[model samples]
Target: MYAYQCIYLADVYLCEAGKLLVVPMDGSHWFTMRSVVEKLIERGHELVVVMPEVSWQLGQSLNCTVKSYKTSYTLEDIDRAMKDFAGTHWTVRDDNMVSLWMGSGYNFFELVFSHCRSLFNDKKLVEYLKESSFDAVFVEPFDMCGLIVAKYLSLPSVVFTRAVFCHYLREATQCPNPLSYVPLNFVSSSDVMTFKERVWNHITHFQERLFCHHFFKSVLDFASEVFPEPVTLYDLFSHTSIWLIRTDFVFDYPKPVMPNMVYVGGINCHGGKPLSKATKPGSRTQHGYDPLT
Candidate 1:
């Protein structure tokens, strides 16, 4: 019976053994993607992570192949940009808010696109991708670089996000995004928006669209050199198999979602280890919780 069970497990493992090409945005985005990678590895799938040199150490620790590429920006650059723009008092009404959003978006796009361009220039990486046979590409579609790369390799792609809502992804999927009721991610409003808030949301959504269009136009122009003829980011994204969003209705406002969009909120919370003795209920001391005890 034990031998039979072992054979059964081996067959299951063999059945589940498929290669995945994971393309994640740099910096804290890796932390968000880490759980997904772990889940894939647990399910017996091989992962090929294409990341910046700074995250090579992290990739080395994972049970998968790591492809490191040199990039002009580092995690520190992202951190600095966030710190410069992020503050408590900023609001949609503030003039500086627009500047903040624009500046931050530009920095993020520059970093992501620059890294992607570096990967495109890497002959060895390109050759390896061409040779590799992946079941699917798992990507954080911050820009369409992941989709472009997946197109180059002729693999199906799955786009995932840690954000509550992504306007670009919504547009790509042609998902319903009613600005009247649905607040923009940057806009601090609820599902039941006031008249003024609804108007503000519309304006913000328009701005976002314009910003993305300009940036994506430039990205696609650069991508034409790397991707084959008759390729567009919209086409690539529309054909994606699924979008695993890290949000749930409980924590987020009600909104219409497409069939391909899967709400995987609290995926990281599930199957997590229980709290230790010190943090567990009734384990706290008068002085404080003693983890060593």
Candidate 2:
């Protein structure tokens, strides 16, 4: 009986295996996405990861094909840019919140735009990817490359994300976000709102729309250059077939979720080594060498 079950499972796994194209976000965002990648590889799927040449963790020890594209910025340049952006918050104090965020956010946003331009300009990589004939695109929608690629190739897209920046997920998915009960993350700190809080939420939603128009100007322009028809960031995101939300429902507040959204929280914790007593926080260490050291 056990032998027959093994043979049946093997057949099912063989049938399910497919070629997967991965366009992951650089830095810590890649951490959770890697777990999904590792699982797919174990399931006998062929995986291709596309990334910038100078990314930190994307280059290390992947048993799959990787296509690294050149960028305008070097690793050192990126480091300096990061420090420059982070240092702004430490040095300056502005009373006006709008100006504070706008100044820093816009400057930081320029790097992303530059990277996007660099990717698009690499004619060879774009052409190769178009002809690769992959099954689907698994993307971290933090950067819109994966979303655009999926649409360009007309391949089904799966989004592996924590949250879409600027709370764009609500608009993109056409998911109803009733401000009275459903808290706008940018507008409110708490989910449960008072009458006054609810009223402020509605007012702030309008203000956010106005801000986002200016904030996403580059994205709108980029979309026009990429595709013939007019496309917005929300439109690209709305094309996603599956939304793998990295959030635990037990710890998270009650919120509306769409039919396609799956909360597979703690994905980063998958395949991790068991924490030894010494390695665990606040753990008693008998040996002289402690994990804290």
> Could you say which candidate leads in TM-score?
2
Question: What's each prediction's TM-score?
Answer: 0.76, 0.82
Clash pairs for candidate 1:
none
* lDDT by residue (tens digit), candidate 1, 1-293: 00011224645732436778988875566676887788778877778988777542346478888898776777778567555555423643443344654566556556657777878888898889888877788888775678778777877788877662236677777888888988777678889989999999988877866665665665777777775675566766776778888767678788888888888887656565654444445655533645578
For residues 13-42, write the lDDT of model 2, one tens digit per residue: 324467888888787888778877887777
lDDT of 2 at 22: 89
Each prediction's number of clashing residue pairs: 0, 0
In candidate 2, stretches whose alpha carbon ends up further than 4 angstroms from where it belongs are 1-14, 88-101, 270-293
Give the range of the ten consecutive residues with the poorest summed lDDT in model 2.
1-10
What's the true lDDT of residue 185 in model 2? 52
Query: Candidate 1, residue 26: CA error in Å?
Result: 2.2
TM-score of 1: 0.76
In model 2, the clashing pairs are: none
Task: Indicate the TM-score of model 2.
Answer: 0.82
